[model samples]
Target: MKLYKTYEDLPKIKLPKGQEVSISDSTLRDGAQMPGIVLKVDHKVKIYEYLHNIGIEKLETFVYNDRDRNAISMMLDRGYEFPEVTGWARAATSDIDLVLDIGAIEETGILMSVSDVHIFDKMGLPSREAAEEKYLDALQYAVDHGLRTRAHIEDMTRADNTNFVYPMIKKILEIDPKCTIRLCDTIGFGIPFVDVEEPFGIPEMVRHVKEELKAVNIETHCHDDFGLAVANSIAGYWHGANWSNVTFLGIGERAGNAELEKLLLFLERRIEGFDKYDLKSLFEFAKFMEREIGIRIPRNKSIVGNNVFAHESGIHTAGVIKNPFTYEPYPPEVVGGKRAFLIGDSSGIEVLRFKVEDTLHDLLDVKISVEKNDPRLRAIQADIQNLYNNEKRVSCISDEEIQAYVEKYFLFEPIVEKSMGRKTL
Candidate 1:
């Protein structure tokens, strides 16, 4: 193994130039809205430092109240600078003032609901023109206040970009070319695949905004209603999205937001020069979130999942025993996770040998050598199989069972003369 002094000295392992996307963490805001997930003011300080040191470019904080405002202030006073902190707010000057007065955030994200459902059904506005005017008024107020703004078009996937969204973009650009607009998939209504049109397909919508809508500095914000948040985010990235809005573990309202870990893992693989993201801290972050938020991580969650690196199937264990890459896309250590193997009813003989030779040799300081057709190995395997099949056992045999069996069998001296045609050991 070797270390590189500079990024130039390292191997090129990114998607490509000009396709790099920035990350804006939404854990403290939208993620906090998760039903049972809650974080106090003190937690924000550590979380902020954690995100900053890991090179996360931005963190979304809440400017709606004093608790969040004071927390943001304390976090800033800690002098962590990498993650330029931003606050989530409505598209209004008062909210922006509330955040800016704390002297913490230089930028803020404002919600601009674009879907007809929000425009008519929710806001009770006369028409799209009325709703557009309402958001424009708020945008104008934000722009006049000299605060950098991220106009999040909420429920974007459920709206007609041509009729409703395009006009808003034109108005926004006229208001100020510096304002960054976020395309929000409010209900996880986005589809990742191509050969599709607007009303939820992200690829076509992303391209449309860039080419036709002439929107500048587009951001991608997706939900996990259909379990396509990560996929939708990647699609937006490939289609010229400049930013990916994410949460720590995809924890948010309803389904959730795109997972920061999943997005970074994919970006690390496909996008060149996208290596600045601290991948190793991800596992710790996941664990910390689980402990602090009181939500257990699902065993099969991607990248940071408990069982993402756990192998148990006989065939999978055998392949992984030879090479981890045979059964995994990336090494468990890459994410600071340990590779684990579980022996069960589907266990094979090679797995048994691997378990004993690889694990027991170091612990017991005893070597148990057995051939492929060894009668002792067959007897042990028969017992294991009988436990599951013949004896009606529901669970797999434990390591203690195998260990006791092996210890007893090894104690028996091999000496045969009359039982077989040849002497056997």
Candidate 2:
């Protein structure tokens, strides 16, 4: 079935000269916060190392407890070269103290509410001014402690950028010129579509910060409630923001975050000269997390899902067999995946021919040359159709069943010779 729309159809976007976009994998902090996700200390360490090995620019973890603290410490001791370790915490001195005690992270994200609802309703601050003061004080403390800070603006899309967010960011730059300001769509409300306006307008959002707030690196942290987390992050890049905050498999609060693999895949394609990251290890990392976190990889999940490279329909399978790129955006091998031509009720003779000539021969150690129009191919195809229509099999023919068909036709047995004499159907 057709999806609602695709990013492919959108007009090509090109960023200005000297622009840079990098991705930070947040599988430790945001992804770990998902309900029912409980990572052991070793799980955290493994995840951090995996993200580092895959060339993620940064790793964000929350040292909320002993397990997390120990994990962070261990990951640091390993001395990963690519992903500089980062910590996630509220805009409080206590959180900063904990991060300092963890002793290995180079940076930390200090949560500061920028939206009216978050400042007043969530954090219970009397006014935006008071909220900014409190957050700035904590940020200053972190910078004074020699920690690079990412001023995480919660609900940035819903926040007052002109008066509250922009002005506060200027003050943060004064305290720490190297600090990163992460614009967060905490509730998945941001959508970076064409002709969008403020709140969901990513280009406007980035320009609002860059134009007036002084020089600072920008990161996009979006949720998937609207199912546009990845799109919003890409928009952030197109506009001005450089860093993208993503989680593995898009696992996080409620609808989840932008998928790390999905974001990287797009960056490799859309952004020129951005293919340095080692993408092959990403699939292994996804599988490792799926095993450790006890979450099922949805069959249809983007990039790493089972069905992402599995073909079944007649036209799709035939086209894919001819050239994988015919019916696909890119080869499955691009991300360490294999292509599978799934024979089913809708499979065509072209699919059957490929399966017999390639797959079955390899699987059963049988040599056969079944052309697309071979009479034996038609006979076996009729048998498969009969199995589907008459027997009402819930699934398509199995490898064993296909082998049987091949054996019956080519390596004919004496027992079933009478059935063949009835008529060639």
Candidate 3:
């Protein structure tokens, strides 16, 4: 699809061509940097395998300690070619040596704080020229050691692109023509609109990098402080950047980064050649993150959330019972999620009928044609409504309660046998 259709007259975001978009995960590195989170080697390995199975192209990790090195070694030994294990380091020769000591990683992201805020306030550098020299020297050292480099311009959203950003990237390309430029929207000041100027506009920044600086490979690494990480990342791709740096659940420092599952779903639906990813694995991976890593998935979170496909309101359930498209944006099965008719205070008789049918089919493997106006269905609905109307219930009716009601009112063996020739309910 060239454009995601919303309305014929409304402006649509045009999809960029001539460059295929690829996803690079930072779950093992940046994601682990979230406060109060520590991923052991086993957790890292399992997360790596999960990312590989979900078709991630690359994953960046730290190599500062033996635990990090051992995780890299185990993942590399698996011989998977897609998610090439890469390294992350500060723009220092000592950090470069840490990556080199691993002796297996071929590429590493060299962090260069481009903004004056980071260069001066964070690193306490004397001048922008000194910061540029230090970053360039480190890039040279990495290239000299036969390691492909990704120049991670930290805090690019707040940097001066004309004098500092462009000149430094130009020199980085001069040092290694094949170097990848990763525009880090550190602290998430990036805006997706192209009309906005630099220091805020992600599209303008990406365009300058691709069109002006002539960088061959560009990656967009965004944060979610403004809740625009995915939007800014997509904006970068639409403008020209080919690589999207993401984490599994957008887990990173502060507000986290662009979510891998959210971006994958967007690319799968909006762009071509992204259908190769196993979208079903998204729900499984979210569950794994929640179960193993103790990261709670919000019930209302998009794509893999529990309530994304659930219908509880009376009008919604009624419409969904007729046609699920009336309430759902996409099929629940598309992401390994199931359609649920949750019984609650606002639910209607349609939900009761659906629950009865589903329970019967699942438990007894029998189907009985029941009319929508059947008294048995109404009675079951009344029983549920009574819990709220008279009993002052505050929680949603559970499936076990619905099953009991269905069994009590509708599970007549004679009626079931007469309808479907089944001897059991």
- Superposed model 2: Cα runs more than 4 Å off: 1-13, 363-367, 414-425
Residue-level lDDT tens digits of model 1 in 126-225: 8988778878888777777776788899999899887779778878878877777788999988999887777878988888777776767888999999
- Candidate 3 local lDDT, 1-425, one digit each (tens): 45533322223234765578799999999999999788999999999888888788999999999999999999998998869999999989999999998887899999999899898998999999999999999999999999999999999999998878888898899899889999999999999997899788998888888888899899999999999999999998989999999999999999999999889888876565457687877888889889888898899999989999988998999988887767777778778898888999998777777788888887788886567798788888887788898978998989998778777876652234336555776
TM-score of 2: 0.90
Predicted structure 1: lDDT: 0.79
Error of 1 at 273 (Å): 4.1
How would the candidate models be sorted by lDDT, starting from the highest? 3, 2, 1
How do the residues 1-425 of candidate 2 rate in per-residue lDDT, one tens digit apiece? 54423334434346773587788888888998899989888988888777776788888888878888788778878976868878888988998998898666768999998889888888888989899899999998998899988989899889777767777888888998878888999998887865667676777788777766755698899999988898888888877888999998898989899998888888776665667776777777778877867888988887888888888888998877776657777667678887877778888888888776764576568776766777777887888888778867777666677777777775674234345455556
TM-score of each predicted structure versus truth: 0.87, 0.90, 0.92
Over 4 Å off in model 3, which ranges?
Answer: 1-14, 362-364, 411-425
lDDT of 2: 0.81
- Please list the C-alpha lDDT of all candidates, in the order they appear: 0.79, 0.81, 0.88
User: How do the candidates rank by TM-score, highest first?
Assistant: 3, 2, 1
